[model samples]
Structure formats: C-alpha cells, structure tokens
Target: MKKITLLLLFPVLLIAQEKATTANTAQSGRYDTNKFSQMYDLLATPNMFRTASGAPGPAYYQQQADYKMDIELDDKNAKLHGSETVTYYNNSPDSLEYLWVQLDQNQMAKDSQTPLAESEKMEQTFPPSNFADKFLKKELERGFVIEHVKDAKGAPLSYTINHTMMRINLASPLKPGTSISFAIKWWYNINNYQTEGGRSGYELFEKEGNRLYVIAQFYPRMAVYNDVEGWQNMQFWGGGEFALPFGNFDVNITVPADHVMEATGELTNRSEVFTAAQLKRYELAQKTFDKPVIIVTQQEAEIAEKGFSDKKKTWKFSAKNVRDFGIATSRKFIYDAMAVQLNDKVVMAASVYPKEANPLWEETSTRTVAHTLKSYSAHTFDYPYPKAVSVSAADQGMEYPMICWNFGRPDENGNTSEQIKNAMIGVVIHEVGHNFFPMIVNSDERQWTWMDEGLNSFMEYMAEVELGTNFPSRRGPARKIVPYMSGDQKFLEPIMSNSEGIIQFGNNAYAKPATGLNILRETIMGRELFDHAFKVYANRWKFKHPTPEDFFRTMEDASGVDLDWFFRGWFYSTDVVDIGISNVKQYYVTETPTQELKNSRVKKGRFDLEKGPFVYLVEEDNKELRARDKKALKIEDVTLLAEYVATVSDTEKDAFKTPKYFYQVTYNKPGGMLMPILVAITYEDDTVENFKYPAQIWRKNNQNAVKVYATEKAIKKIQLDPELETADIDLTNNTWPKESLKSKFD
Candidate 1:
C-alpha cells in the first residue's frame, strides 16, 4: 500500500522533475515524445501518386520497357553473347531526355568497384580454394563487352557506360505518350558458382564433364522509372538487388542440341525442340495434378551428357507483364512437371535437376513448389504466371520471376539427413514464394530489401507449415528473434534502414520483419484482422511497385487499429521489449484514511472509488514483528466494516459477503519498446485467471501501470507474458515474489 500510494502521486512528481529538467536544459520546442502519439511527421506526405489509404491514386503511373532478345551460350568457352531490342514507353507525366539501362553483369568485371564499398580484408580462417582465388588465381575476362548500340533506324546511337549502368542518349525528348526503340550487342564470361558463390553462374560436374547453367541479369536491362523516385538508378552493388520496370519479353536462346532448358516464360517452341516421346509426356503433365510426369528421365539424360552435340538448337519463349527473365539449361538435366490449381487457374509446377540431386530433389522439389503457390495465393493473390520452375544448384538460393535456383543434394548413395531435407523444403518454398512478392507485387529490392525478402519470408513461413507437418521453419517466431534483438545494440539497425547499409542483413531484413508480422497476427491484431489487411495490401500493389510507407498505411487502414506505436518502436528505432511485474502487495480494510493517500486525493480532489467508505487500505504480512500491531486492531474492530455489516439486511447478508482480500499489482517496463501486458494469476485452489491490458494502458503513464484486484481466493503467484508473445528480452523479473531459477545443472 505504501508503494501504491506513492505511485498515485507520480503525476505531481513528474511535473516538478520535468520543470527542473526543462529549466536546466533551456530546450523549448514542443514535440510529441509520447509513445502513443500519431507519427505524422515521420511519414511521407500523401500525394496523387500514392494515396493516404495506401492504394494507388487516380493519377498514378508506371513506365514500361519491353524486350526482344537473341541469346547464345558458348559451352566450350563458358561465355554468353546477346543482342537485345528494347522499346521504352513513357506512361509518366514528365518527359524523359535519356533512358538508364542496367548492366548487372558488370559486377563480375575485373575492374568492378563493388569491393571498395566494404574495404574487405582477409579473414583469420579460410578454405584453400577461397585463398587461392583471392591471391593466386588470375582474374577472368568477365562482365559485358559492348560491341555496338543502334537505334530503330539502324543508325549508331551514342551511349555512355558506367560500371554497372548504361545511359542511352535519345535523339529527342520522349514525350509522355511517346515511345523509343534501340538495340544493343554484348557478351560476357560466366563464373563457376560453387567456388565463386553468386546469384547466377554455371556449376561444373567434373566427374561427368558437363555443366549446368542458371543465368539471370545476362542482358542489359532497363531501370525503373516511377513517380516516387523518378529514376531508380542505383547501381548493382551485389548486396542490394534489382529495381526494374515491368513489361513483355520475347527471347530466343541457342544451346547445344541435346540440352534441356527451363526459363521465366512459356516455351513457344517446345514442340519444335522436344522429341516426339517428350512431347507426349509434356501434354500429360499439363493434365496431371497428384504427381509429376517425367519428361526427361535419368537414363536418357545420362546418355545425352556422355557426348557433346555438334549442332545447336534455338528455344523461343514469350512472357507478358513480367518484371524480369531468367533461364536454366543443361544436357544432364532430368525434368518433371505437375499441375497446381489456384481457384480456376492451374499453374504448371516444374523441376529440373541432375541425377546428383536424387532422391532429395526428386522427392520434394516439385511438391514444395505446388504447396507454396497455394498457401501464398490463399493469403495474397492468385499465381498470375503460366508456370514456376525450381532448378537444383548447389550452395545457392536465388529467385527470378518464374524460375529460381536452390541447393539440395544427397550423398552418392542417394540418402540425406533430416537437416538437409528440411533445408531443401524451406528454401524451395521461400524462392518459389518470391513469385508472389517482388516478381508480381513488385517492390524495389535495391532500396528496401525487407519489402521483398521480409514479406516473402513471412509468406514462406506460412507455406512451410502448410507443406509439411511440424516443419522446421527458420524464422517467424517471436521467441526465436530474442537473441538477435537482445544482442549488441551497436551492430543492429532499424528495419527501415537502406538495404546496403543494413547491419546483420539476414536478421534485420528477413527474420526481424517476419517475426514482427507474426506478432501482429498472433498477439496484436489476431489472425482474422491481420489476414484481411495483409491481403488488401497484396491486391492493391500486384504488378506495381510499393514502398515501405504504403505497407505501413495499408495495414492500419485495413485493420482499423492505430498501429503507429508499433511501427515507431519496431521499425524506426532499435528498441527491445522488457516488461515485468515490479511489485505485488495485499491489503485490508481500515477505518481511518492512510495519511499518504489522503494527502494525494484530498489535495487533488480526484479520488473516485466505486465502493463506499473506501477511506484507506492497510498492508498485511505474516511476520513476528507485526504480531502486536495486528492484535492491537483486528479488521472486525474497524467501525466502517461493522457499520456496513449492520446496515445489510439478514436476507442480503449471504448475497453480499464482505471482500476478504485486496491486492495491488504494478507493472514496469525497463526496455524502450511498449507492448500489451499479458498477465496470469494463480490462486491457492490451483485455478488460474488470465487478463489482458491493451497497449494503450501506458498512454498516460509510460513507465508503470497499476491495477487493483478484489478476490475471494488468495493469489499464490502473478506472472507477466506467460506465453512470451511480445519478444520480451528479460524473463528473470517477469514474476512477482520471484522463484529461484533452475537450470539443468541444478
């Protein structure tokens, strides 16, 4: 009761302290420092391009860049040559003088400046191969070698090459409704992915003398032009990924005659390229749903890889409204496909892997792809593409529009550990799930990695659960992120940080945001509300670029919840949650008012007790020293109690038994973050009572929140956050009358 009375007087004390601090500091500008205040200043100003409701406004516009490419892969030389025709359409309000093209392959150039960004140094421990590649191995002739740039009229067009980006000088200003067309020719050497470690490269099977190529960013592509940033000209720094415009693609790829190929778009020349036997299997696969139909079997692939073909064949593909394109080709591939139904649409889920990937890839790859599409489509939108492909590439997981490369290979005997199986399933779901994120919903990964990786990872977590029973997902649990959130604060950054500058990129971009969204779904907003709101954001931004502010606004706008406090604490600051029960005490009825509470209430005239004659409360404890004081005046001797008892009629005496117990509990937050207080009260009878105080409980008092309970049964213990739903960092102080911690050694 002593602690409770003084806590009631905190307002006067805070005012006095604030005045003293204000006078000493001489700082006068007023600001909304309250955690529950609306964060209007921190948000971008709403405009016609992006509305306050998080949907695209009436005047919103996005630029489009269509491509027609002829690409050839030289197997012996390990080089790629391409000639592309790009048509740029200006859908924006402003006219453009020049167009920016992305030369992403230049990142592998010998003169690439990417390494200078990190000022990399040799580590203490390294593999012999990595050491050799760093110090002894000669630099390869990689990156694009531009031969010519020609306009639509066959005249040479002037262009400037800057490391990973090219600026095409237009003959005249391209108006809002006009379009421009140009052509470019280039070639570059590909890297060995296993030893080099990158997004796209060739994996050499030395034992068989064959190579599997997974290619992306192979051509000079167009950069994004939008209303928000005008021109997203950020260079390809390897860490920060791409920001591109959406358009149609028509590509023709030339490869060895026996090679099997899978790419981002539908294969228009499949009948012309596939054998008569293969064509029959492919048609059956389109109607198959339960299991995959194998087009190229292991026995056939084994014979094809033994000898190289002298002639070449060109495979043609066509895609509509896709942001990017990718291709995977190898003579050693075993191909399979199955149909997946999403509402009325049936998408082809396909896989391409060598015999080395069995039985892991053969057992799970295509199935995982089907499950991810269903789970994500249930939450976001339907899969818009004709097909999605997953290819086996060791030591890498990278996603393009409809095609992605993953790592999953068994030992020589075709057996795998539980760890490898789970890893394979999780990575497949994550990469294939990317099709729903930046591939279709289209966020700028170069600027905000979390919008794609984080959102996709969250959806991936859900898909993993639907794909397998008791799946071992790596993220999306509140408790799993505690270690990273509680780690050295100097190395952590806010989730809104720039992609390249982010510290602990995986946890910051992939895990932390996923965990926060899970908390919102499970604890804050509940599943029904969070699900509907999340779906709204997906439907609004599909095939368009969305920013961080758009997501923040859409969530609150759809959920009918003021989540400014959450966004401010979790996304804007490096704050951790640490809420606990500070203290608990029991009290009894008293005839006279305690001097402390009397002083606070009488002076302020603010006491508003529900029960009558609630003058005071005296704390009680079982101590020898308090025996005399307890015997001096029993609670029955209090005149107020006796008078109330006498006034009650005999018939109502049973109906109104006097309250025998009163307990006051106080909760305190040591960390900077604010969260709802979840409490569980245990009684001597072993029954428990659960109570939840919404996050607004701290609106008036940010440091401490107090509650009073009157119960018939005595409470044995009180615990805060019994389920650990808020990602609280410290658990040692979570219980009042704290028990001794017991570890395994104990």
Candidate 2:
C-alpha cells in the first residue's frame, strides 16, 4: 500500500570522517541528518476549538468499550438481528453530553444519503458499490434507525441522529474519567462485502448444494475518538476500511441448528453449542500440533445443507479486549484448524472456504496464515490471539484482527493459475499482517492512512518474501515501485496525506509506502536495525493511539538511527530516485627526474616530473636479483627520468615516501531521495572493488559528489547498486560508461 503525504522539507546534517573520532557517534549523526520535521509539526499542531479544558488539545480519545451481544442471522430473510450492551469507559477528563454510534450498514440502505448522492452521479461507465446492489436486492433491510438511547442503569436517554452518527444525549453529563454502560439493539441486511463491487459483507459460496457464508461489517458500531477528529464521521464509502474504538465484546450469534461457524473470538459455550463428535474433535485439535483436525466434515455439511433448519443455535463468544467482531457461518462451510506454535502457546491457524476454494484455499490459506504469524512475529510482536482465520471471498481482500477475508477461485475444470495461488497467499499474508498494524498497533487510520495500510503492506512484503521466492508480492519490492514513482508528479501524493484525499488512489497511498519501507529496510537501514525498531514501535503502541510521529520517532529512537531524512524524503515529498555515475577519472604514480619526465611527455612530461621528485636509485647494496637467469630491465621499467630532481641529497631521502594512485569518481543524485552510494569499481587487472559513502555525502551538496579512491590497480568499470532495486526510478544514470540503449521491438 502506498503512503502519500504532502511535500515537506527536512534538516540535513553532514559529518566529515576526520572530525568524528568515534565510529558509533559518526554513524548515528549521519543517519539522523535526514529527519522528518513535518510529521512532528503536524502532529504537534494544537487545536483549541474542541478543547474540553478551554485550552488547546486533541479532540477525542477512544474509550475501552465492552459489549455483550445476542445476535441471530435470518439467512432465509437475509437479515441480521443483534442486541448488544456496550460498556464505555470515559478516559477523557471532560464530561460527555452524548455518545455517538456509527451505523456503517446504513450506507448500504437504499435511502442512504450517500448512496442517493452517488446514484445521481452514477453513469453506465461507473457502477454502484458491489454491496450496494446486494444490500438492496438479496439482503433484507429493516429498522433503518431502530435504536434507543439508554443510561448505565438501562433508563431511557435522549438521542439524535445527525446523518450517519447517532448521538446519545445522556440524562446527565457523564463526568470526566467515568465509565458509561449502555445497550442498543440493532439489525441490518447482510450482503457480500465485494459482491457487485462493495468492500465488505458476505459472499454465498455454494458447495454440495449448500451455501457458505463469509460475513463482514454486518452491524453498527462506535466511531473512533482521536486527537484530530472528535468522532470520525466519515461514512463507509465502500473501498476504505474502518476506524473504531478498542473494546471488549461478548457476542452470541445464532444461525440454523446444523450450520457450523467461526468468528473473531473463542467459542465461550462450546459444550452447549457443539455435538459430542465435535467436542471430541475439538479436544483432539487442541493436541494436533501439526495439521488441522476437521470439526465439521464435508458429508455432515452436505447433510446440514439439505435442510435449512429454522431452529437457531446460539454460539457465544467473549473477547476480553477487541475493537470489533465479525463472523462467517453456513452449513456448507468447510472448517479446519491447524495448531501454530507461537512462543510457547499454540494458536490455531484456521480456514473456512467452500469446495471451490479446494486445491487452493483449503490447502494454502491456513498455512499462509501460519506463515504470517511466524514472520510478522519475528519482525513485530507475537501472535497473541488463540486463532487467526482466513475466509475465502471475492473482490478486495480486507483485514481484521485474527480474522481476514481473502480472494481466489479455481477454474471450471478445477485449474488455478500460479498467479492466483500466489496472489491468495500474498493477500492472506497482507491481511493477517494487518492484525499488527492498525488492529493491535492501533493507529488513527482515517487521519493517517499510511500508519495502517503502508506499514501493514510493508510487513506484508517481508512476510511474503519469507514465505518463498515466488511469493508474488505486489506492493513491497523496491523494483516494483519505479513505474509509480516515475508517474506524472501532478497526480501523485506523499505518503503523509489524509487517507481520503490522496491522488492515484491505490498505488500512491498503499504500494508506494510499502515499497519505501522495504527500500529503507533492505538498502538503507538494513534488516537487523529496521526489524528491531519496527518491533519496538509495534509493541510499544499496541492497543493505544499512535500518530505518524510516534512511529517515526520510535523507529529512529529504538534503532538509534536518525531516519528523519528517510521519513521526510519518502513520506512527505513526491521524490523519485534517479542517481547516476556522472564521471570517472584515473591517475597513475611515477618516480623519475623532473626535467627528463617533463620533456618526455608534456602530459607525460608533467607526470614524469612529479614522479622524478620521489625517485630512488636501484641501490648498489641491492644485489639480490643479479643471477644469470634474471632478465634485464626495459627502459620503461627504469625510465629515462626528468633531471630536475635527479640530484637529491641524503636529507631529501629521509623525507621521501612512495607515491600512491588517486582517482576521483563523481556521482549525481538526479533523484531527490538520498541513499548510501554503493558503487562497484572494476580494476584494470580484472578485479572488482566496492566503495561505500554514507548518505550524508549528499547533505552538503545534493548536486554531484566526488570520491577519491587511492588504489594500486586502475579502475576498469564502475556500477552503482547493480540490482536495479532501491526504487531508483531511473537506471540510465546508474552506470558509468553509459550502457547502450537496445531496441527490444527490433
């Protein structure tokens, strides 16, 4: 995912090698030179308007909320019914006049103001969100605004719906630092998140004449309270994900008697809900440390699918601290669980897909989830949840903590593309990685989208790479970013922009940031440093609100590298990397008399004269090579020297030292982004040498920087970061003795 921010300047500090006595201090200073001041300024900007203390402050703070929900899915009517009791802890010092609840599903209502506005603008070329049509047709829509405001004691309280937000007017102001418990009963239509074109909901995957359920965002929940926005009023406009308050939930979902289900939390009443065989199998799965033990078999699913029993079975789940809850259930759902040993505990890596997902999702999805848990844990934090689920759906892949929806399907003849397989694996990894980014490492995504999408996408790339060589990572590879970086600058954005307003949508906001972080990890700071810092950030801010500054600061702080420049150049500005080897000059040392050297070669003469000053006689005492088999020296070996310095006294010999060759190679940074210059220089004797100059070399002069190499062998060729990665954007300048352009078409 690209993280597009507005352009901003960063301070640059260059370090000279001679001045720094300590290597550690010098390296730290060099890395810190390019710090992102813009992020700090933006985050620190005070807002007084929403201040509860009558002073400047952040607008809202998400309270730790707990919910006890009793829900029933009326599949026959395509409706969802739920009544949840929410306990909201007021951490803010100020008292709340009212609390707002987000009715996300309302956006799908036919009469919604957004859809109405969108419908008027819709032409044949532009289609409505996939969930829009499904919401209006296949899903039942009712109780458009069926909610009652209540106090902690269950007494009625005044409430108002100002468009998308339902404001509950408390009977009396809930004082500062207080907890408010209330209940709201709500039900909504169920539609696939990506049916016609929408982003969340359920898709009906048929297997053995049974339809499997893949559900998401089926109910209304609370909006986020943050520093920037008091309450996020941004409507679920289809593609973008959600921003919510962290809380606990006790959800009870009831479906048909025979239907099996899996959701966001553990099944609290498994004994009451599952059959004797399921209980025994569940116990076995707990010990099955390797592969998944099937809880619901295909034959049982087919039998259940034959009759859509109206009898509802309640499956209770209680999550201690969670932001949201989602579930997938169906008689045709094929469920499997594999034990993933994280740290010492065993977390279940599960998958729920139809027979269509067979040969693909059935085999790889769970394993990919396992991989995500492992790789991401190594980089960020451990898999704390008991289970991580991957459910097969169509359209865009979305992530939620411990639960994610994936997209992949086989051909009519059961043939699937390697592309599809890799894509599924990658998507699953990307989604599950989200459990770390916005979910546990809770960030205000609406305000700073990059914090969630960009960071998750970055880890997504790393996780994918760890998965295998052919893991088809679409967003994280640096080389894959060139096209987007080189695109029309007018249509681009820096990764620091507001989520909704960024240009170039997907690539600019999501993929670029991911690639930028990858470049920083691989080519800039390296894996060891980057991973440690990233993990620190994740662990430090888990379940709390973190801004972009928190992330930038924590990474640099933990890594002990001043990454200001990296954040500034990559996140705040639309800078492209286009560095090249501008020039290379070679020189040789000679020892001869001044006059003869100057006269023999004017270009050679001056060289001869310079050599003459340091000339030493083949001493009479040096008689070691006087053997009969020894060949005589040529004039070139004992050249006729310039005579100017031929008469050196004994005292001059005491001051004389052997001359060394020097070559100055100049490099140009056509790209605004500064990176370490990794240059490979080939010598005349078919030998290669590498010279590294820290990024600070360009701090003093961003135009062209020159480096002098003192070597015995003459440089034959030179190349810079030959792999064509680093998101260089332009490789034309990447080599000395410019490579000849070849026409592939010809």
Candidate 1: tens digits of C-alpha lDDT, residues 632-698: 2343576555655666678876786455567889899998898999999998898999998989999
The best candidate in terms of TM-score: 1
* Model 2 C-alpha lDDT per residue in residues 189-241, reported as the tens digit of each score: 66644443455655664454445566566655777765555667676554456
The lDDT per prediction is: 0.87, 0.69
For each candidate in turn, the TM-score is 0.92, 0.81
Q: Give the poorly placed runs of model 1, Cα more than 4 Å off.
A: 1-30, 123-128, 592-615, 621-660, 742-746
Clashing pairs in 1: none
Cα lDDT for residue 7, candidate 1 = 17
